[model samples]
Each structure stands twice: as structure tokens, then as C-alpha cells.
Target: MEMTFPDAAPPFLADAGWAGAAIEPIPGDASARRYFRLRRENGTAMLMHAPPPGEDPEPFLRAARWLDANGLRAPQILAEDTGAGLVLLQDFGEVRMREYLDAWPQDEREVYAHAVDALIQLHQLPPGPFTQYSLAEYQREARLFIDWFCPVQGLYVDLKSWTEAWEEVLGPLLARQRPGVTVLRDYHAENIMLDGGLDRQGLLDFQDALVGHPAYDLVSLLQDARRDVDPVTERAMLEHYITQSGAGPHFAEDYARLGAQRNAKIIGIFVRLWQRDGKPRYLDYIPRVWALLERDLAHPALAPVARWFDAHVPAALRDPTGRLGGTFAV
Candidate 1:
């Protein structure tokens, strides 16, 4: 039987007058939020399943409007039932920019240029209301490696020593932060939607936006965890952004600092996904993430954390376990 929403719709969706909508689950990212691409005789929408007490749509709505006002593309809110942890959003289509670029690699430069321009525009906007991605937050995220990952690897972390090492590692980043901006905390290729609009770009997964250094999202784009961006292309995008944005002299240094910080956090997060969330798929990306982390640690300022990793975690565990080390993107 061709399914419709009446029987399948949850209590909330049925109450929201979507009882007859045709719905299909869309692939989701590494978030608790679930999505269903929905179509009814009246209109089409994307239904977000953000089970509250853990997920909320208010932040997403706020960030979306803010992005829309700032000359970028975020989805329009169709309807929201925050109390039931559900919201209906304008469907921005299924074509993620990553899929588009990969299918048509010839257009990568132009597409990435547009993405960079979006970041440049975002950097100029005044800070938004959110968690400040402060040194304390960075430290807290990095400690996830010690808390969740170490035990799984059959190792003990010396918290006191590790804390001091991170403090030293984070010193240069703290001292050289740019004025805060609304950092779309996960502004990577996958989160970018190829909405066929004037901007040709739409942002997703930005509910976790933060007030932090401008270079943070830049790192997220150029040093992607899920895909391998070619080095020449990556360099061109960086130079283009610097020229267009009139970024200060410390841009490269700050970028490397934040890149390493982000990659370190990924190590912990990937492990947590496996340990607590029962998702082992993230472990597959550890090799790529580790390679990126090594490059980040090449910055002289990050040596403390580098030394700490070497001392405790051992070299073998840095990459994915067993044969994953060999399949790295060249």
C-alpha cells in the first residue's frame, strides 16, 4: 500500500494537520534530529524530529532568520511545535553541495568560491546570541578524548598533566583570536545545501552556532573531516578568502591553531559516537581526521598536545584500527 501520514504520523504531526502528507526519511547527519521530506496536496516541507530535553528547534529558527537577514540562505520556517519537539521547514531540496561538487568536479572552484563568499559575508556580521567558543569550551571538548577514548583503548590519562599540556597548546589561540563572529559551528561541505537560488548555497546544521573567532568555519570548510579536498584547491580558496575578507596578518596562524583544535575534538567525538551512541561508522574517518590533526600539530604552538598524544595514546590508535590506515585519500 502507498503510505500516507494518518496512521504513520506521530501524534504531533497528526495534530499539526499533516495527517495526509506523504513522507520519506531523509539521510541525517551525526545529530539526534531526524528529518522527513514531506509532501501534501497543499505544500511540501521538511519535518524535523528534534526530540526535546535533548534537541530544540528555537535555536535553529533563530539562526535561520538571522542568516536570512544577513544576505545568506537558510530555510524558511513553515510551522513549529516546540513543545512536541517538531517543526516544519521549507524543503530546500535533496542536493547537498558536496554531492553536486563530487558529481561535477569541474565546477568545484566556482562552487567553493561561492561558499567562501558566504563565510566572508558571515564574518562581517555582528556576533549572535550563543555559547562563546571560549578557551574553556575548547578545553572541555578536547578532554572528551581522555574521558571516552582512552578507556576504550586500554589506557589511563593523567588528567592533571593533560590539562596543563592543553593549556600550553591553547595559549597561542587564546592570545590571537579575532573579534567574535557568528561561527556556523559545522560549516562544512555536507552542511552546505546547493539550493538553486541566487546565492546557490544554503546552510544546514547550524543550530549549534557560536560566537567565536572568524577562522573557525574556514577551518571546517577547507579541512573537511568527511572528504578529502585537494590541496591546490584548498590553498586557492584560502587565499581568495583572505584577499576578499581583508583578514588580518595572523589569519594563517589562527587557522592552523583552530584546525588542530577542531581535529582533536573530532577524535573524541568520533569515539563517543561509538562508545555511547553505538555508532561505529565514525571510526572509519579517524584516519583522515588523524592525518589532518598531524598537519595541524605541525604548527610549533601545538607541540604540547602533540607530545601528550605521543606519550599516552600510542601511534597505532591514532588512525582507525586495523587496515584503515592504508586507504587514506591521496
Candidate 2:
């Protein structure tokens, strides 16, 4: 594949130290950014090609420093050219957890347990000045569903009717919950790497880390993209997390509720990605997420909201709202 950069390659790479480096394109996430593996006489380093002025690397750098300082495996920054939006970082390689899972399905439990341990390690950190994710921010993100997906489906929603209900149900639910340390907002299969000899996994794409619910990142991992985890395995992992963290029996209930909320928000996000960003591949994962939401709703913890959904929201609308594979005009 041809290399894609937002702008021309930086002039520094042609200088004395980095001359004759081999620059190879590396896989990236769902962002307008690119990465290259730069192998030079100095050593192997990863170059991040984010467009100047639009996508600043400062946040990523700061988050990386914070995570690295706290016993996590974030890429170490080696060199940076802020003016050109290029950053040289430790090469964590391109083996995503999704690929590893595909190659070794039998190791899913053990591998996922490691990820759970990582989450526990992260949540153990004391509160810091990192970003905070509030109900208002979540509501703002939820609007993407109305603005993007609803239009694509040719369905108009009375924002006044459901918006308040959503906020009302979720507002206190999130507000009353105990706050945690930083959360790696996108800690899923694609963002983790199982390096061959490394004792711990490598973390990537954590620039959006926030101080939010303790279970949020764990839910993001076990309930992931690129694969469907068996319900039996999901329960075991949930129990393992609860036990290992000493969060007590109520932890399971809290985990289920948070998982439901997180899954609902993600469904909306995937739909918005398809409708607005033209990334329709994410639509394939809708069924898995919907199944999770439905299963979570079955739990007694969510009975009130689930009953509301069953009564006010039609069964046909459930799958559509969940972005399952159904052709609805737009």
C-alpha cells in the first residue's frame, strides 16, 4: 500500500543522523493520522504523522508520560518535531490483540486476564489533574446519534422527548457512582499488543484517557471489537476482575450497569462513525454490542430503565437504534 501522510515528510529525517532510514507504513486506528516504522542507524523508532495544527501530539505525549510513570507500558517519546507534527516513539510493533486472538483462540482467557490486570493497575492510581468525563460530555456525544445516524436512516427523533429521558436516567446513575483514576477510553482488542518476549502487553491509542468510572475500560476490553466473546467467558472474566480488585459482591451489579451504559454509548458511536465518517465496516460489530446491551438489560439491576425501553421503544426500533443489520431507507 502507498504511504499516506497529511503533508510532506519532515526534512529532518534526511539529515545526518536519520539519513537512509527505512520508513514503512504501519496500521493505524480510525483517525486521520498515519504511522511509519523508521529503521535507521540510530535505532528503530515509530514516527507519528499527524497533520500540523489540526491534530496536536501534545496530549498524546503528556498521556504517554503519565501512563509510563505509573508502571504502564506506553510508548516512550524519543524525538519530536511539533512544527511538522511528527513524533518518534518506541516501536511497540503492529501486532494488535485482535490478530493475536484470531491466531490463538485458546489463549483468550489467559490473554484477557492480563489485560484485566493492566486495568487494575491503572485504576489503582490516585486521582490526578487529568481530564474528567461528565454526564454533559456523554450527552454531547450521544447527540451524534441524532445528527448523523438518524438522518442517514431518514428517521427524525423528537429530541425533547428522549433526550431528557436519557439524561434523566443516566445523569444520576453516573453522578452518584464513585470516581476512579484515569480511564483509557478506547482500551479494546485493536489497541493492545502482545509482543513476543514482553512480559506485559503494550498499550496504544490512549490519548483520550479520562478520569471516569473504574469499570469503563474493563468493559471496553472484554466487550471488544473484531470478535465475540462467549457469555460464559465474559462472566468468568467479570468475576475475576471483581475478585482480584477486592471490590466486593456489589461490584458485579455495578459492572453490569456500567457495561450497559458503555455499550449503549458505543452503539451510538459506531452508527455515527458510519453515517458521518463513511466508515461502514464498524456496522458489522453492531450485533455483538446489541446482544451485550440486551443481556445487560436482563439483569435485575437495569430493570427500571429496561422496562422503560421495552414499553416506550418498539421492538423493531430496538435493533435499528442498536444499529443492527437492517435496511431502513437511509
Candidate 3:
């Protein structure tokens, strides 16, 4: 994609003593935020352009500061102009965990071990400065599946029943998150940077951090949407986390609940990305996410949700593929 800096980006970089730095635009994720790598004679830094109205940099700044303060590896902010939505951050370099793992599949166990350890490390710390991931939030997110996914499949699923089913299962589990730990909502391999080393994993896209159940991030890691995580590696890491974190026996159940919730949300999001935003490429990941959701629904904790799915959506309509069939009536 042809990329250009936002209007305020140049002056903002110049004020930060990066005048005339070569700018190379970085491909963005599913968010409105854009990024560029700034290269000067001496060093390199990352410029995050979270444009106003659609995107804001304040939450990212707050999360970055909190993570760094608590000894995590969120990028250090060299300069910022929140009003203009521009931030220059420490460059963590190109070694993302997902890409690295693809190249060295043999290192999966060890690399995943390091990631599990990082989660244990974070869960032990006090929650970051973010709102609790409340039951309402969970329900609202779960509704996305019916709202977006069902319409695209040309199936008018029961939105009310979907909400009730999620709430029924999610309510009791919600109590366990009291005095919760920081949850990086998107803590998958793609958002993890392995620049320095495995021990010091660099966190990216953590602006959506929440104070919630520890299992949420684990689901994000082990059941990634973008790529397939080996089943053996996933099981080993989950066991490793339970052992190292000293979590209760019920932790596995909670992991399944959150997995169902997250995967369902992702399916809705991928559809929205295609139908609303005209980004159809995200549709390719729905099959993978559907498989994860199917496993999640099998767990007893998600029985209510499973029944809802069984009653409303047919197996043939479950996995949406290739430029969905019908118009999503908003």
C-alpha cells in the first residue's frame, strides 16, 4: 500500500529533534492507527500516528507508561503530542515472535515457555490503570458474533438468546476476577516482539489492556487467530502456566470460557472488517477462529453458549469464507 505521513507527523518529529529523518511506513493492523520507522544518522525510533477522531494516543501512552513502570518491556516514549496523536517510541526492531517461530519451528516449546513465563510475571503484578473487564463488557463483545457474523452468513440468529446465553455462563466466572491482574487483550504472538531476547519480550498493541481474568491473555496467545499454534505446544504452555502461576484447578475452565468469548468476538470483528471497512483479507482467518471456538464450546463452562449455537446456526453456515454471501442489514 502506498503510504504517506499524517500532516502533523513531520512537524511533530522535527520538534522532537528528528528533522529530515527518513520515514518508512509500517503496515498497520486492524486498527486505524498508522506507524512509521524514523531513521536518523545515529539511531532509529518508531513513530506512531494515531490520527484524531478515529484514533487516540492517550490510552496507549497510559498503558505504555504503566507497563514500563512495572518492569515490562512496553516501548519507551521518547516524545509525544497527544493532541496531535503522534508519538515517537523506542524501536524494538523486527523480530516478532510469530515470524520467528515460523522460521524456527523447533524452538516452539522454548519460545512459548518464555511467553507463558511473561504472563505469569504480569499476572503477579497489580493491575494496570485501566477499567476492569466487566461482565457487561464481555456480553457486549459476545453480541458482535450475532450482529455481524450471522447477518453476513444470511442467517438471522437470535441476538437476545445469544446475549442471555453468554451472560448466564459469564456471570459466575466474572466474580473470580476481583482485584484482577492486567490483561493484555491482544497478547498473541504477532503483537509480541522478540527483539532483545526471550526473557524480555516486547509488548505491542497493549493500549486495550484491561484488569481482568489472567486466562484471557492465555487464550489470546495459545489460540491465535492469524496463525496456527501447534496443539502440543499449546497444551504444554497451558500446563506450564498453571504450574508456574499456581492457579487453581478451575483455571482451565476459565480459559475455555474466555477462549469462546474471544474467538466469537474475533469472528464478528473479521466480518465487520470485511463488510464495514472493506478489508476482506481478514475473512481468511475466520475458519481458524471457528475451529478454536468449536473447541471452546465443548468445555462444560460454555454449555449455554454451545446450545445457543447449535439451535441457531447450522454447521454449514458456521465457517464463513470468501466474500460472504448476503448484504449485512445494519
Off by over 4 Å in 1: 1-19, 41-43, 197-199, 319-330
C-alpha lDDT score of every prediction, in listed order:
0.80, 0.72, 0.89
Q: Considering lDDT, which of the candidate structures 2 and 3 is the better prediction for this target?
A: 3
lDDT of 3 by residue, 226-252 (tens): 988999999899999999899987889
Ranking of candidates on lDDT, top first:
3, 1, 2
On TM-score, the leading prediction is 3
TM-scores of the models, in the order given:
0.90, 0.87, 0.95
Give the TM-score comparing model 2 with the true structure, all chains together: 0.87
Tens-place lDDT per residue, model 2, 1-330, is: 236743546565654255567878886666756888888676777888776666888778889998898899999987777677777788887677888878888888888888888888887788445778787766676565556545555667666755675565556556544565688888888888877632469998987777877777877887775578766777888888888877655566666676777776777777776776777777777667777878777878767557655755456656724454454223
Candidate 3 stretches with Cα past 4 Å from truth are 319-330
Better lDDT candidate (1, 2): 1
Error of 2 at 21 (Å): 1.5
Report the number of the highest-lDDT candidate: 3
Which ranges of candidate 2 are over 4 A from the true structure?
6-8, 14-16, 41-43, 172-179, 197-199, 311-313, 317-330
Residue 206 CA displacement from its true place in model 2, Å: 0.7
How many residue pairs in model 1 have overlapping backbones?
Answer: 0
Error of 3 at 153 (Å): 1.0
